[model samples]
Target: MRAYIVPMARSLTVALAQYVPLNGPDEVEVLRSSAAEMCSAAPGLDLIVFPEIHLCGDGDDAPDTNEWLNAAAEPLAGPRQRALCRVAADLGVWLIPGSVPELGDDGRVYNTAIVVDRRGDLVAYYRKVFPWRPHETWAPGHDFTVFDIPGIGRGGLSICYDAWFPESTRSLAWMGAEFVVNVVKTTGSDRAQERILARANAITNQVFMLSVNAAGPVGAGGSLVSDPEGTVIADLPSDEPGLAIVEIDLDDVTRVRQHGTEGLNRMWSQMLPGDPLIDLPVYSGHIDPATWRPRGQS
Candidate 1:
């Protein structure tokens, strides 16, 4: 396995903004103002993350109908996106403006996260691969995206339900991602589990994980940052809107993999002797029912 090294500054400052959920025309303005406040409060932050469906608020109370979700969805180049880009530029910071209900050209709505660079340019877009089953109306995303920021190290993007699947983060790590920004919209009941999963993902992948969740009655507001060692470095209040800022060393990713006993990359290389897992023709066909059944089953 090839070792990944950090080429820029050894450390980065990241801020997680636990945004309050509000529904109205002023929602965008509220977020813009909140982001500005966060920036002013914490100067020189390289990245600031918001919650899921931030512009169009998570539909916690709305009817479970596609009509409602499609109505809230907007094109990638819509005004909301442009406004967020402006916010990034004004603050002079890289921004993950959370997930948006995107109205794709195919006429289907997708839960998407748009990443903006410090210069206010849209750098990458990652659609959620897994939508919360039986409830979410958005389509699943087919691709995983990781991109580079000129000064900062490489980062990956994933939305709420995507983090539940280990392959989501694993793929990013395989692609040389040093850190992941996960934007989420979770209820109070799921907050604890979300934190556990965040820590697990960070530890197993040996990468920095920042999870930014929403606030308000519908949201749990447990925005947190986990280090490569699965430690919760910083966290915000679960019942209120706030910002959790922390400084992390990107070089730790390389250091951990190089020195740790059971690093993920080293384990994978050891397990897969020669051919890559994707190149193997396993689990592609149906299994025989009689070969694998419960001991008591007929």
Candidate 2:
């Protein structure tokens, strides 16, 4: 008899920079410096993620969101965004500068999040779809976005309020996303509920979840990371700037989905080819048996 050995783990090192946003003309400088310092301290950091709208801070305090947007918003091609992309390239690390106030060519502002790869290329940008209503005035986005990390895994991007909608995570998972990063800046009392939703989203989707919230004056903090089994692997305190450095094994997502969450409940596997097409009237769609499982599994 011969012993067998499995291959190496596909792990990803992520740093959740839950810091207070420096909302000013030099905010981009502050971001560059902070990211450089983080890369220096933690060498080989695969990804660095910030909170939602960190560039603009908590501008909702103004008479109207547009008032703050007029002063802080920048076009996608502006120097500030380009500078942030350079930081990722220079540091040789993936970076998500959180959500920024994007001055669209249509003369409307959008709460947008951009992804910069290790090569500093602006790969993907997601405009927030489900903006916090009545409070958020920015134009809502129409589509969801996901990106790949080469040998690591695929990742999806969603903003603070998007987590409130289950369809967001489910659709991303269906698109072959191994993990979803929900950048957040929650200053309200609903953070408690948001935490639960994070774990629930991970468990139901069988994907890793990183909810990175801001801290100090702009947010209530309490950032967290949930694994494929719905276990909160890392978390930060409330109302304070902190960093949550988490290393996740993408293999765990495959393991849980294959072997079941606790070796018992395999939600995706529950739907078989012979099952009927379940109709969802709310979205005016139906769950096709041909595409019911995870992207590749189907």
Please list the C-alpha lDDT of all candidates, in the order they appear.
Answer: 0.79, 0.88
- What's the C-alpha lDDT at position 22 in model 2? 65
Candidate 2 colliding pairs, count: 0
Q: For candidate 2, lDDT tens digit of each residue in 1-298? A: 5333435778999999999876666787888889889899898899999998887754656677667776677899998788988889988999999988888889888899999999999999999999898877889989999999999889999999999999999989988899999999898889999999999999999999999998977788989999999999999957789988889999888888877888778888877768899999998999887787877653
For candidate 2, the per-residue lDDT at 206 reads 96
Query: lDDT tens string, model 1, 1-298?
Result: 8465555657888888787665676676777787788788888788888888876654555665456668888899998889888888988988887888898999889999999988889999998999998878689999898988765578899898888999898778767788899998887587888889998889887789999998867688888898888888898856587878899887787666665524434332233234333432453744233332212112
lDDT of 1 at 93: 89
For model 2, state the Cα shift of residue 78 in Å. 2.1
TM-score for each predicted model, relative to the true structure: 0.85, 0.94
Global lDDT of model 2: 0.88
Best by TM-score: 2
